[model samples]
Target: MQSYVNVRHSAQGHPSGVSVLCVSSELCNRLGACHITMCGTGMQRCTLNVTLEQAMILSRNHGLMPRCIMQTMDIMRKQGPRVELSAKNLKVMDQMTPAFPRLFKLCLPPSDGDL
Candidate 1:
């Protein structure tokens, strides 16, 4: 028996698909180790090709400006992260906020309390 791994892609820089091959022992011996065969039908991966105009309309429906989206994506690529607060800190703050109502209430002065 013979097995082969194939890397496939379209000439336009898109995914073509993935395929597997299995051969009989006799054919494998005849073909030797290196064998090339055309990929069978239904090998291409499913894809959706949308034009720029259609994409823009879709973006509009989603309330996104194409230019702003592009800029935001670029900024994301440059920045390590968008939010500074750590998840631990956020969780701690959430827990403490409910547990210490008096601490938060201290921000407002009591009418009869000492200055």
Candidate 2:
């Protein structure tokens, strides 16, 4: 858990990198924020600060979530908002599972290094 939070936004900078879509923190919701950095070169380093409500929107609409936040959201949905989730307590949910199919597939760098 701390490992993910301590993650830097970038290791090697990339021209086209990870993008953190903006969420409404002021007007819409302001519960919490998640800062995540993807691990790769030629990629963007970003920290997304968003409310819990906004996180749900991203997962529902765009299927995007910072790793830890996603698990937190799952706990919130299942256990209700009053409960808090610890990394040790919250079991990470699989997005691709039959009950929760992913709408988008991750596009990774080529294995052969053709790019």
Candidate 3:
């Protein structure tokens, strides 16, 4: 999932330009990893184990921008269930907000197919 946050101006009304946040995953030989890329003011890239929660937290602390982080989390919260259920025998055990880091739980689907 990817989200972009455009900052047109700073508090002083100076042009600050735009920034982009991209989140993607790779699976190779049953080893999966997640990567985050930030581009605009500067560029940064990092790879980590496939724990999106941790990745988001790290990104938030890394100064990628809050709007970008929230947008990415919203996309994941909306699409996560479908992605989880597409597997042959997988189930969603719990739904938690990655942005707030366990502060809230999302309502679960009534059935796997219902999502």
| Highest lDDT against the true fold, candidate | 3
* Candidate with the larger lDDT of 2 and 3: 3
- Estimate TM-scores for all models: 0.18, 0.20, 0.22
After superposing candidate 1, which stretches have Cα over 4 Å from the reference? 1-12, 15-63, 82-115
Please give the CA lDDT of all the candidate structures.
0.35, 0.38, 0.39
- Alpha-carbon lDDT of model 1: 0.35
Q: Residue by residue across 7-80, what tens digits does model 3's lDDT show?
A: 45789998543232222332221255533333332111111122244445556456656456556545655565
User: RMSD, each candidate, Å?
Assistant: 25.7, 12.4, 16.6
> What does candidate 3 score on TM?
0.22
Q: In model 3, which runs have C-alpha deviations exceeding 4 angstroms? A: 1-52, 78-82, 86-115
Cα lDDT tens digits, model 2, 5-108, are: 22235557542321222333322335555433334331112112223444556654576655655565445555753233222134443232333123222344
Q: Rank the candidates by lDDT, best first.
A: 3, 2, 1
Number of clashing residue pairs, candidate 1: 0
Query: Model 2 reaches what TM-score against the true structure?
Result: 0.20
Cα lDDT for residue 52, candidate 3: 41
Error of 2 at 37 (Å): 28
Ranking by TM-score: 3, 2, 1
